[model samples]
Target: MATSYDYVIVGAGSAGCVLANRLSSDPGVRVLLIEAGGRDNHLIVQMPAAAPIAARDPRLDWAYVTEPEVFCENRHIIEHRGKVLGGSSSINGMVANRGNPRDYDAWAAEGLPTWSFAHCLPYFKKMETFVGGANEWRGGDGPQSIERCPATHPLYRAFLEAGVEAGYERTEDQNGARHEGFHIAQSFTRKGRRCSSAAAYLHPVSHRANLTVLSRTLTRRIVFDGRRAVGVEAQTGGTISTYEASREVILSAGAINSPQLLLLSGVGSAAQLRSHDIAVVADLPAVGRHLEDHQIVPIQYSTPEGLSLSHRLKGLRRYGIGLRWLLFKSGLGASTMCEAGCFFRSSDRADYADIQHEFYPLTAEMGDPEANFDDGFMFSMGLMRPESRGHVTLKSADPSEHPAIVFNYFAAERDRRIMIDGMRRTREMAAQRAFDGLRRAEIAPGPDIQSDDEIMAWLRSAASTEYHPCSSCRMGVGEDSVTDGEGRVHETEGLRVVDASIMPHNVTANLNAPVVMLAEKLADAIRGKTPLPPSGLVPH
Candidate 1:
C-alpha cells in the first residue's frame, strides 16, 4: 500500500467495502480499504446454514458482551460484529430484509428530508439484484444477489399458515410492497453460497491497481489537522503505521467502533476525552450517544422429531449436508435455517407493525452443534422502534480497549408494554390450528405462564439482542445526532461515517441489507453527485 490515497476508508465492513468498490470505480481515484481482521474466504463463512457458527467464531466475529442491562434482570447480552472483510454481513443470518419504508419517512420527519423513503428507495434498488426479479419495488441489476428462501419444509408451511390462521394477511413478498404479514424470507445467497458485501462489492474489483486493501490492520485513531481529519494511524501485527488521505477519511467501522474511534481520536465529549488524557479536537457531546438495538424474546415450541431443522443437522445427516454443499452447493447447508419470518402490529392501537418475527426451525441456539438433537421450532420478536437509548464510551484512552456499551434495553414503559404484547401475539400465532400438525407443546413460558405480569417476568429472564445495533452516530440536525444526512460528521471537514452507525433509528428488520442500501446512498452524496429522484409513492 502507498503512503496516501484519495479515500482512506477505515473498517472494511459492509459500508467500507461498498465505498471501496464505488469510490474506486473511478479509475482516477485511489482508494484504501483497511480491515482489522483477515480474509473472509473460509468454508464456514461461505456455507449459508453455518451462519451461527460463523457469527460466533472468534476468527470472524468481534464477540462483544455489553455492560449489565438493569432492565433485563441485569443480564449482559453478547453482541457480535464482523471482524473480517465483509464485516457482519459475512457472519450474519443472511436475511434480505429492507425494513419498512416508514422507517426512512420517520427520519425525514425529523428534519432529514434527503433520507426519506422516497429518496432512499432508488439507492436501495441500486444495491441488490433480487433473483425474484425487480419491478417498481425491487432491484434486478446490482452487486448483492438475493434469492427467495425455499421454505418447502412442512414446518415453514405451518408457520405461514399459522400466521394467516391468526388473522394476519399472507403477503407474498416481505421486502416488497407489503411490509406487514407472514411470508417466506429472502436471503443474500447466490446459488447456495453466502453473498456478503465483500463477496458482492470488494473482491470483484480488488485487483484494480488503484484499490488497496489492508487486512489485519486495526486503525488506532484518525490523524487530524486542527479539527479536520487528515489521515489514519493504524497498527498491523504490533507495528504502527500511518496512511494519509488526499480527499477524505471515511469511517464505516460500524456503530460501536465508529463512535469509539471518534472519541479515541479526540473528537467526542470534551470531559470524557480529558479524563482519558486525550486532547479534545471537536467537542461533539453526542458522538457516542443514542445507541439503538433490537431486544428479541424467543418463543419456542416442541415439534415432531424429524420436522425441525435440528433433525437435519445431527448424526450422519450433518456430514451429508456439508458434503452436498461442498459438492453441489445445495441441501440444508444451502439455507440459513431461517426460512420464514413475519411482521405485524402488536395491537390495533399501533399505526404500523411494531413487532418483527424470525421463524427458526430449531429449538437449539444457532451456533451449538451438539444440541442438534433438540427437535423443536421457534420464533423470536423484538419491538421495532424502541424508546430507550444507550451509548458507547471509552473505558480508557488505550486504543486496544473495547469501549463500554450500555444498551439500557427496555428502559421505557412503552418498550416493555410492546414487548409483552409481542410475546403474547407470538404465542397466539403459534397456537393457531395450522400449527397443529407440527406443534406439540410450548417449550418456553410454557402453558402455565399467562397474563401480562407473568409474560413480563419471563421476558426479563430471556430477552436477548437480535444482533441489530445501530444509530450510535445517528444522522440528523439535533444535539443527539452525530452526523448530517450525507454522513458528514457534524463540524468536521473531510471526514464521514457511512454505516449502520449513522442510521437515524433502527429499522424494523435485519441490519445488513439496509446497511448496504445506506452505503449505496451515501457513496453518491460523498462524490457530490445529484441525489436520486424520489419515487414519490408511499406503499408502506
Candidate 2:
C-alpha cells in the first residue's frame, strides 16, 4: 500500500526543508520530505570553510555540467547543485545576500505583484536572524542565523578601502538599508557552523510527529491523476514505490531538476513530450524556458607571501587549523573566506548595480585540487542581471539521466559589454593605492590582454557561473509562465514549484539566501495565511 501525506515535498533542499517545516507545523497535517542525497551531517558540510570541497564532492553535489555554449567558446560549464538535504545551501559559499530591492520590483512588473520587493521584504525579514539586529529590513528572531563577516583580515580591509578610493561608497550592511557599494558580507552561519536550511528549519522540527523525511530517495516523477498531481513515484534502496499526497505535491528540486522533473512527468511542450515518447499532461511550452544564471570571471593577482589564506593550507598549518576548528569551532574553518564584496554599476546606464563582486584572499586553479597558491588574491565579478537567457530540456526519457542545460552566457551584446566594464572596474579597484603594499602582478588575465576583442575572447574561455541559476520554471502572470505569483503551476492543481527555479528572474546576488526567502514566502501562501504587509522600504 502506498503511504499517504497531506503534502509531499520533492527534494529536501533549501526550499523543501522550509516548506516541510512550515506545512507540517499544523499537527493535523502529515508531510513527507524526500531527498535524492544522503544525510548532511558530514564535517565538510558543517564547516563553512569546506564549501569548495563540498561543491566538488559528487556525494554532496549534483555537479551538473551545462551543454556547450555557443557564446562561451563552446565550453561546457560546471553547474553544481546540492544533492544533499538543505541542497545548495549545504554546499554553497554561505554568503547571505538578499539582492537589490529593484530585482523583485522587476518581477512585479512582470505581473507578479505579490513578488515586488516591498511585498517580499517582510518574508525576507521573517526568514533570517541577522546579527546586525532588527530594523525595518533586518530580522532579529528567525530560523536562519545570519552573521556579519568580521572582516578582520588586512586583505579584506584593503579591498574595502580600495573600493572607497575607486569612488564607491562603503555601506555597513548590504542587505539592510542599501545594497549598493562595498561592505562586509553576511553569512548563513551561527557560532562558526553552517546554518543551512536543514539546520535552521528541518532539523529542529524533524522530531515532529507530522513530518516524515526520507533521505537518499530519488523521485522519478510526479504521479498525476488526470490534471492534478497526486503524489510521486520514487526509488529508495533500489525499491520502487509510490507516495500519495492527499493535498499538494511541491517540487523544490532547484533550477535544473525541477524543470527536468516536470518535463519527464509530461507537463512540458507537446512536441518535446511526443519526441520522448511520453504522453503530454499539460503541454506547457514555457516549462523549461527563460533560464538565467550569473556568469562570472575572476580577476586574480599575486599577493605578499603571507597575506593570502592559501599559504595556511599547507603541511602542519592545515592540520593545526582543522584541529582548532574541531576542538572549538573557531579559526580559519569558521569563515567561508568570501568575507567582503562590492556591488556597483558598470555604467550610469544601469538603474541599479549591474555588477556584483566578491573578493577571496586565496586563489586556486579551477578544477585543480592541488594548485593552492602561497600568495594570491582574487575578485570574481559577474553581471548582476544578464540579458542572455538559456533553457533546460530533457536529454532522454530516463529519469536518472541528467537534463541538458544551456546557459548561453554572453549571448547578448549588452551582457558582454557589461562584463567587460566589470572587469575594467575590478582592475581599477585593485590598482588603488590601498593595495600598493600587498598587490603583486596580475595572474588570471595578465596585463598583456588589453584590447576589447582580446578581453572578450578571454571571457569566452574563462567566464564561469557564480552558481546562481534560476527562472527555468519561473513564476509570472501570463500564459508563458509555468507557475503563478503564488508558485502554483499554471493549469494544474495541488502542485507547485517553490525553489530558485520559480524566480521570475535571477536576483543580483548569490542565490542561496533569496531561494530560502522564496520558500518562506511561498509557505505562507500555501498555508493560506494572511499575506505579510509590504514594508515599503526603498534602498537609499
Candidate 3:
C-alpha cells in the first residue's frame, strides 16, 4: 500500500516547518514534511555569529548564482539559500523585522482580501514569542522565539550614534509602531543559539508519530489527477517515489523553486510549456512573474581604533569566543551576522519611506569563504519598495532542470529612481557628524562618485540582491494572479502555496517574519479558526 498523508507539505523551510508543526498538532491529520536537505542540528547553525560559517558549508546551503546579465555586464551575483532542514533560517542574519504596516495594507488594497495590515498583525503576533515579552499586539507564548542581541559590539555604538547624529532617533522596537529609526535588530536567537524555524517548529515534532519529515528527499514535481493535486513525485537516493496526499499538497518550496516546480509540472504559460514539451496542467501565465528583491549597496567603514568586531576578533579572542559559545552560550558568538538597522523615508523622496539601511558591526562578504576576511562595521542600504518585475522560466522540460531567473532589476524607471534615493540616504547617514570622528575613505562608489546618473550606473554595476526573492506565484484575485488571496491555487481543488511565492509584494523589511506569519494565517484559514491577538505595543 502506498503511504498516504492527510497533508503533504513540500520544502521543510520557514513556512513548511511552521505548517508541519501547526497542522500536525491535531494528531488526527497525518502530515508529511518533505525536505531537500538534511538535519539542522549542526553546531555552526546553532552559533549565532557562526551564520557566515554555516552559509559556506555545502551541507547547510544551496549556494546559487544568478546568470550574468547585460545590465550587470560582468559581475555574477551569488544568491544564497539554505539547503538544510532549517532552510535559509539556518543561514540568514536572524534579524526578525515584520516589515512596515503600510506594506500589508497596500497588498489588501491591491485586491487581496483580508491581507490588510489589520488582518496580518495578529498572525505576526501568533508566530513569535518575543523575549522582551509582548503586549496585546505581540505574542509572549508562541513556538518561535525572538530575542534582542545580547552583546553589542563597540562599532554598533558608533553606528547607532551616527544614525542619531544624522537626525534618526533610537527606536525601541523596529517591529512595533514606529519603524523609522535606528535600533538594535531583534534576532531569532535564544540564549546565544540560533532559533531557526526548524529549531523552533520542526525539531520538536520530528519524532511525532503523526508526522514524517523526509530529509534529503528532492521533490521532482506535483503529481496530478486531472484538475487536482493528488501527490508529489520525489527522489530519495537513486529511487524515485510518489507520495499521495489524501487531503492536499502545499508548496512551501519558496518563490524560486515553487514556481519552477509549477512550470516543470506543466502549470505555466502555454507557449512556454508547449515549447518545453510539457503538457499544460494549468494556463497560468503568472506562475513565474512579478519577481522582486531588495538590492543592497553595502557601505563598509573603518572603525576608530579597537572598536570593530574585526579588531576585537583575533587569535585567542577567536578561541575564547568559540569556547564561550560552547560553554556559557554567551559572547560575541551570540550575535547575528548583522546587528542594528534603520528605516527611513529619504529626504530626497516625496513618496513613502521606500528605503532601508541595515547596520552590520562586522565585516564579511555576503556569502562563503570562512577564512576570507572583509571585517569592519559595514552598513548596507536597500530600496525597500521596488516597482520592478521579472520572471522565472524553465530552461528545459525536465523536472530536474534549473529554471532561468531574470530579475530585470532597475529595468523600470521607478526602480532606478528608488536605487538612487537609497544611495543618497546611505551617503547622508554615513556623512553624519557622529561618524565624522570614525569615518574612513570611501570603499565603494567613492567621493568622486556623485550625481544621479553616476549613482544609478554604480547601482547597476555594484548593487546585488539581499537574497530576498518573491512573488513568482503571487497572490491576488485577478486571473493573472497564480494564487487566490487565501493562498489557494486558482481553480485548483486541493493545493495551496504558503511561502514567499504567495506574497502579493515584497514587505518593507526582511521577508522571513512575514513568511512565518503567512503560514500561521494559512493554517488558521485552513482550520477555520481565528488568528491570535496583536501586540498593542508601539515603537518607543
Model 2 residue 484 lDDT score: 87
Residue-wise C-alpha lDDT for candidate 3, range 1-540, written one tens digit per residue: 336998999998899999999999988989999999898889888998887778778898776666665565546666778888878988887889998887887898999758877788888887889988887557798889998874355567767887788777788888877767888888998878899999899888878889998999889989999979998999989998999998999999888889988888878788999998888988888999888888787766665566667754676778888898899998778867577788877664544567777777655556333534455567678877778877778888776666787777676788777777767777777787767666676767778889998877777777778878999999988866899877889866788898999898898898889999999999987776775544344333
The TM-score that candidate 1 achieves is 0.98
Error of 2 at 293 (Å): 0.5
lDDT of 2: 0.90
The candidate with the higher TM-score, 1 or 3, is 1
* Winning candidate number (lDDT): 2
What does candidate 1's lDDT look like per residue over 17-81, in tens digits? Answer: 89999999899999999999999999989999888788878899777888998988887788888
Model 1 CA lDDT for position 425: 83
- Residue-level lDDT for 540 in candidate 1: 47
* 1-540: candidate 2 lDDT, tens digit per residue: 339999999998899999999999999999999999999999999998888888888899887888999998798888888999899989988998999999989999988888888988898999989998899889999999999988898889999999999999999999988899999999999999999999999999999998999999999999999999999999998899999999999999988999999999999999999999998889899999899999888789998778888888877998888889999999998988889999999977878899998888887554333224446888888888998999999999999999999999999999999988778878899999999989999997999998888889999988888888999999987767899888889888899999999998898888888988899998998999998999867678
Looking at candidate 2, what is the lDDT of residue 295?
89
Name the 10 consecutive residues with the lowest summed lDDT in model 2: 365-374
lDDT of 1 at 404: 96
